[model samples]
Target: MKKIITKELVPGMVLADAVLTPKSNILFEKGTILTQKDIAKLTFYSIDEVLVHDNEIGEIMTISSLPDGQITASERIKQTKEFQIFKADFEKCAEKFKNEISDLVAGNKEFDYKRLLAPIYELLQKGQTNSAVFEMLNNLRNYDDATYTHCINVALASNILAQWLRWSKEEIETATLSGLFHDIGKLAIPEDIITKPGKLTSSEYSIVKTHPQKGFDVLKNVTISIHVKNAALMHHERCDGTGYPGGLKAPQIDRYAKLVSITDVYDAMTSARYYRAPLCPFIAISMFEEDLQKYDTEMMLCFLENIVNTYMLNTVLLNTGEVGEIVFINRNYLSRPTIKIKNDYIDLSKCPGVYIQEIL
Candidate 1:
């Protein structure tokens, strides 16, 4: 069995796994044959994906058009409540972890690896799918205290990227932990500069740039893999010899650092900042495209495929005030995807007049 986005769902396919409603009730049993009506039913439930026999997935010749109206008021409420649950739990974990790390650094004590990683592992497992984790990240913008939350968000993104890259279990764990500790040096920066509502002076900016090296110093004595330690030091290093500290080129940068750098930029750009408000994910993608030399293109492409393309079945509002569901991604242009608006499949890449205003 293989999981596929609902946009790719077609009639005559058999469900390899049971389809459950958002309320956890079984809507369709495993091995059940899917028809147009069943497909519509799943769409109405805001079901994103389903598992089908691997052989059956690619056998469909046509994709039946379905109107988009998946989310209900109740589902919105449920999603909000779900976000709250995750928010509460994340806050608790962040607080405890932050305190523990502070104590570990201040007292020169050994890192409590088990205690430090358990909550993160639990959170990752709780989300289950990459889409669910990204959804949680989108909802997290509703809360404050971005410092601790940013660490958690980056770690989640890093782990997801690691999984997408098909890394080993130990490598994934190290990458996740490395993301959590990447910005540890920021803790040493003065609170006023860290949270400054306005532009910083040249000296302050220079201090801010020292975070990577300072973070490396903090983790130098810690009992973690060298890759993990290097992640803290090199995450800011760019591919074209333009990053920070040593300004190492692509070949000089560590592989783990390259992976973490993508996620770090993604979360940092999408998250609200003291200098400016958060940009939309699409805007962030455009930013990456504008400055391709500053990142690992291969890793960035994989991240876009995993993180951005997961919104395949999402409803979006266009600049023309029309609503549509994203049906396909344009391989040549990741941001300008094909949208299904009623009976028409509008390819944004070809249509120069209209653009997506927001993802509904």
Candidate 2:
């Protein structure tokens, strides 16, 4: 299969993989012949590229006529092995980051942004799309207290959001680095408090709130941009003047800080914590919608749109205890999307009380 940009998609091209809606709905199935409607949907979803059979582009090759049931055993094994390798590499990189962060906290030394940011830059450049990173993030959410991995996830998310906003590549890179250093101060906090399984006392919570300031102190002197330093200090500050440390309002908050702040909350909310299980991405979107005033609305909107689209074509469990694939998304009501369960299509906008429970 060859990957091609959305514009290259034309009628009669066979899909090598399913196309999904932003709501995790499968807009088109693999091996289905494309049509004008399908191309329009792909454009609407802002999909960058899709995998198509080389034969569809005029390359001659033997076609497999095997019946499509569940994935073949060999295909499943290949996917499993690929996931294992991805997970292993991610953990190893995170471990190196943990040690580097430790050194920064212990000796009060300059951060090696070159070394720390290398992996993220490479991942972004290599993948050149959200699919790979999104898959890794979904898997990472199952683990606990992976600080380095969380940082990387936030960085990637910030970059994606910035790119979606049509920001300059330089700005995106800065936003990415800002996210990486946003939690640097957490390294100074006591591990017991950081990973406490129960609710924290006010004093303990107060300690936790000091991370932004501590993080700023650590990064302030580093040979990075002022935006990066301020982002670390102000990521916790809210738009309505209700955040920690300085409690700076929206006008007072740095733009870079604003971007990192969204991703910071996103990664934290989606990741499993000692105190609670991870929330579904849909829940996170709901929270963002409800608290839209607390964040930069434009940034949040871009993030919501792009992030949800990454789940397109994914299998999900519904609140009604049925399994389905997302089939359509109502732009006005992003959280409620039409789902396809076998032959039945469930339009969530029309069916109250039916909601997505989890992405499988």
lDDT by residue for model 1 over 191-228, one digit each (tens)? 78888765467899899999888888888887788988
RMSD of each: 17.6, 16.2
Extract clashing residue pairs from model 2: 22-309, 25-326, 25-327, 26-326
Give the Cα error of residue 308 in candidate 2, in Å: 1.4
Clashes in each model (backbone N, CA, C under 3 Å)? 0, 4
lDDT of 2 by residue, 110-185 (tens): 6667788787776665554666666566665665566677887888888888888999978988998898878988
lDDT of 2 at 322: 78
Candidate 1 displacement at residue 262 in angstroms: 0.8
> TM-score, each model?
0.76, 0.75
